[model samples]
Target: MNFLSQDKSSSRPNKAIIILSLWVFAILLLGFTFRTSLDEMITVWINVEEYSHGFFIPVITVYFLWLRRHELKFIEEFKHSLPGLVIVFIGLILLILGGLATLKTVEQYAFIITLTGMFTIAFGLPGLRVGAIPLLFLIFMVPFPQFILNNLSSKLQLISSWLGVEFIRACNIMVYLEGNVIDLGIYKLQVVDACSGLRYLFPLASLSFLCAYLFKGPFWQKVLIFFSSAPLTIFMNSLRIGIIGIMVDNWGTEMAEGFLHDFEGWIIFLICMGLLFIEMWLFSRLSGRKVAFNELVLIPTEWSGDTKQGNPDIRFNKSVFLLMLLLIGAAIASHNIEGRKDLIPSRKAFLNFPLQLGKWEGRNDYLNQYYLDVLKLTDYVIINYTQPESGNHINFYSAYYQSQREGVSVHSPKSCIPGDGWQITQFGQRDFPDFKVDGNALIINRAIIQKGDSKQLVYYWFQQRGRTITNEYLVKWYLFYDSITMNRTDGSLIRLITSVKAGENIEAADQRLQAFIKDLIPVLPAYLPGKNS
Candidate 1:
């Protein structure tokens, strides 16, 4: 009777393991086969922010799982709730729809479906075992929807701008504040989105989760730690902006440019971590818990085996485990490769002008001048100077409505690296130069510039297909340009242009255009590179 009881109990555990494995397998199969929008969505976050820098995220994940290993090992075979399975299936469907919608180029609406599914799956199940698995998926929060992201980004900009203004003012720097911009008599600085607190969201979220899981306190304490990230991130990011602002005010913008700028980022992050630790220590004292910093009490229970000694690994089931690991690795690699392929441009051809001879090869001078004119009309602007480093191609015609109100003045979307939005749209034609310049007379593509009472449409192109012509040699070229239509409920355009080059140019293109523009719109400032000037 005793032996039979023991055998029955042991069989139960094995059955539970089989069931759990099946569920995990099912989730994986569904996740891979149905396609969750996670790949593309998460890719955007990883591209925009350097969140995956180093092995920080991986290390954190490993540590977190290791810390919970003992507790996780004894996790009961979760009750087989058919209702929960139904809910998970619904979530799976939503995830599939989101992915399909994304593939169809309908991104805005996909998020709703994905979020609904995630929320349903998390809510439908009960108990720690149930919610824990779904909640672990919250790492997807990094890729916020565009609308939400924009709103959050603007909030971050406002915080950074406010701090920058205060710091500059405290330093007795002569400055005029409008929105998120500062006119320091010499240079105008706009506290744009990138500099905003938005950068810390993913890191803070990850850290908060780790702290929550590790802390041996009430559930509310964990919740509090997770929620504290908002204020913590905002406060630290403000400090970063203020420090940078002070540097800019005292030692010119050059002091805050280049790789040194990134160095400041790390310093700020370290300081933020210090603050977090201090706060945690304070909390522990108040709560009267002698919580150890690295304390993780791992214990075995009913489902756990004796860790004091391994049972010779039961003769080592190596082949099956190796194959399973290999499969997981291959899935991850395939996803990453596919993601990279999706990002690269499908076509590589120069744009040819209809009326003019020779294609508008991507010439630097031409591309710069082309985009400069188009952007002038928009109230708020986002520019991409590089392709590989930068992730998206976007020029906001009315972005000013957000940042300008937030007290940011000098706005620039360009950062350190070159990526997307660098190449100009070629329309239907092909062939662009490596670089081209504009003379006094700026040539505008008539087809692109549309005039309307309430709205306007402006299209332009930029390409870099030519080599250095300074040494007296014709340059090779290709054609690329961006086209955009502007809608203005409010009257008045931001920039008034004179002319744009239709094709190839001789002599100094920029000088000629600059002279013309200076004569034409005296109020407009001379073209200055955001990072340089």
Candidate 2:
């Protein structure tokens, strides 16, 4: 009775429980209402990693509680905090505003809001403070905004490409480098942003967050481990690519092409993970602290001293289990939606080339090519032209010429006119070197051609979407160019010339355009650029 009286657990109202409930409800609502583009981007990852690493979150959560068990044992009994609810409300408002403003901004703020809300709820709760780890876990399930991901991925691309080039060149492999592309004589390997090992980021981040919570390492050391993942992942992936290049050089394409490709990625991942474990072990040893493995057991009966509150609520445990089940379901549902393949249009429906043109090809110089195989071509159209003059005026001419050859104009199709059935979803100046359009300038025009298996691709033309021509290097370039792509009946893309430059008169533009068109006329070889099939 004396010991129980000494404990402040009974004095505090169970406000923390109410606060936590509200927090959980809010997050559940957010997860429900918010369908995100980032979520879609990670679909492939979810599919591949779900079975393999799906247990990681729970395993880590349990480990964290174990490590903090000693401290958590004394946590006051659950209590509601009305003030905490106000804090959560404020955070909710900010989070909603952020989501509305921009998905990227919202993603950046998401974790912050989560942390604040969780801490606010856990503040007054003694025994319930352990819930923070689980609350924090929700952030991992949220999709990251595209802007942040794109920028991070781009940086990874540069780092991985640079390291890969250096490593491959060291092997005396006759390779030419251009940005992320490696010209390995016969085959060009563009270290696509995905291959930059950016995929490992979320997993590593998850691990780091868990480590930070579970370990008693120096604050700087924890931060260091988290940030080091970027370079560590990039370097390891580069090494993997380098090894693959060497193997391909010695063994030929067959060994490097199929099974080995996947095998190599896994090998690199394991190696990196092994390195992470070693680093953690070394850090713990150096800090004179033992690793915590069995820290989460329930209090001993001797130490329990009648602190048991009416037999651990079966409902509480059941709620946690049910919540976990629901999370798993939610994750699965999100993945299902994300991975759903687009229904292919019927060939006849797609190929009904209407004389009443809703969308039709305008005059263009370069030939458009469509294909089903992703690796057969660059899946992009190239425009080649030169400017004779200098200054903004010359740049304008290059742009105008390219623009004339790139896209269809809004003018009525002479073949047949549609009463506003066709609306160009996107049309504007392109920002590629020779593909910009400015004030009055010399331009070029040539015949536009469209061919695909189903023919819907000929109508659903692609644009750059959005870009501005403020680049200084582009301003100096003699040629302006860019690419346009349309969706194929299949999931592949049908590439068309989005932009091209022609600084010369119409006659010269016509000559070059004809030559370009003839080179790709009737049929293009499979090896040419923009030929995916």
Candidate 3:
């Protein structure tokens, strides 16, 4: 008698359960496969203020998917894309290569790529087309490499200091800018790492992406809104710095201390969010539309409902099954290979390095334990040499690594010097007129760094596998290359620094470093290996 009123859920075969089960299985496999990278990413999210937003990325991603759940309701049958197999395979290769290289950054990226491939595999191109934005939004969760972050922070500090100084001048307040330091007549304010705007940049950029997704606007307008977060953050942070400087100048040093400093940051961040909305309002008028302020960030018309719809039913196929096998196999294999050690190249230890080269008297120098832990170097040598004839002295230092597979690596002077209260005055590559390495003119990074009226000339480069490189970016590249081709990631950073006396010109300082290089290179190869070694 109740045949006409049968249960609809039972009739439909509970496709959602099947779909979720497949997702759970796949996600568990992914977790196991990338546990090392994922654990590190979580640690960064907890520890690094700049990337704290990473903890919320996945929750937001799931919310986005929930918003588009209506679209999934209408898909007649989930399709497995045969072509996605290639992408999944490629992701595995990247994982293997990254794991072997011990590049956690690369391994983290590979996790995203693998998930992308899995998405493509599970639902095919049509599903991919629908879910692309939510998937790609996960990118904000990954943190940049430490060196890159330091370099970026250093650059932003200088920019902010310059802008803050300009604001002081605009206010009829006198100020002198030295590197990242703003010298107010009464007080000196240094634009250190904390003031670099990175804390605002990452979070605001992530917020902009979410806002852009929900924004009802033209395609170009959405892109503009997203990319503008970086500049907007920089401008607002500079404004905050300038305001603090002016306040300190007029009021007192108390204006820049305690809860007031933190309050200023919060106010600046709120203003940044408000400015984004204002930008949308202005953009609407320019486009000849009167968009309501509240409506500016409303979900687009397209997301309201789906058209050309069909019923969704889970369908398992060969491609998806093969993907499961690959995931399981790779995860188990990686677990076994996780403990394998790096192949360190043979070389003389730095402890045995000669203190005296030629015509130069030397004194051995050592870094404190705190620096030694932070740097995580395998071996190093630090010496100060003086030529008695000219009373000239040079500071020579080199840090070596047996296996720079993960976080341990060289620290570039370009980034580290700024943190040590030294501001870079000049930075560029220079070739020696009298020195050569492997038949080519030796090139090094030349920089004039100053702190509080004291000036120093510095020369530095990276010696890796067999090549000498001046650029920090290239050092990372060759590190990966040699890791793959030569099974070696060993390298050393060579640096020579000399002071510029009150009456001495920079040329004299440069000559002192160059002469030291000539005497140093011949002795370096014994400690730092050549290409063949």
Candidate with maximal lDDT:
3
Please report, as a residue range, the 10-residue window in candidate 1 with the lowest summed lDDT. Answer: 475-484
- Give per-residue CA lDDT, model 2, range 1-533, as digits (tens): 88787566654435446534654774565465334533432462365442234345545555545544444332123334333444445544444433332223343344345344444444435544555655566466554433244445555665676688789889888876554566677666666655768666667666666655545578877777666666678789888777766676777766457777878887877777666666676777788877644431223333233443433321122233333343345345444533443222222221122222111222213323332131232223322223223211100001111121101111111111111112122222222233322211112221232221111101111211122222222311211222213221122122222222334343443343333333322222221112132
User: Residue 219, candidate 1: how far off, in angstroms?
Assistant: 4.1
- Model 1 clash tally? 78
Model 2: weakest 10-residue lDDT segment is 391-400
Which 10 successive residues of model 3 have the least lDDT summed?
71-80
Give the per-residue lDDT digits (tens) of candidate 1, residues 1-533: 99999999898768656645654663464346434344554455467673453235435444543544433322222232334434444443433333322331122233333333332332333333523533453453434444345546765676667777777677777766554666676666666667776667667667666665555567887788777877888877777777777787778897567987878877777776666666676677678877665543222242243576332211111222322343355345435533431111222111221111121111111335564452332232222221233221212121211111011121222210011112111212212232222312222321122122111222222111111111000100110010001111111112212223344231233333333233323212122111111
lDDT of 3 at 171: 92
TM-score of 3: 0.90
lDDT of 3 by residue, 89-179 (tens): 7877788878777788887888888888887777677767777898889999999988888789998998888887887789999888887
How many residue pairs clash in each candidate at the backbone level?
A: 78, 24, 2
How high is the CA lDDT of each candidate model?
A: 0.41, 0.42, 0.83
lDDT, candidate 3, residue 309? 55
Query: What TM-score should be assigned to candidate 1?
Result: 0.49
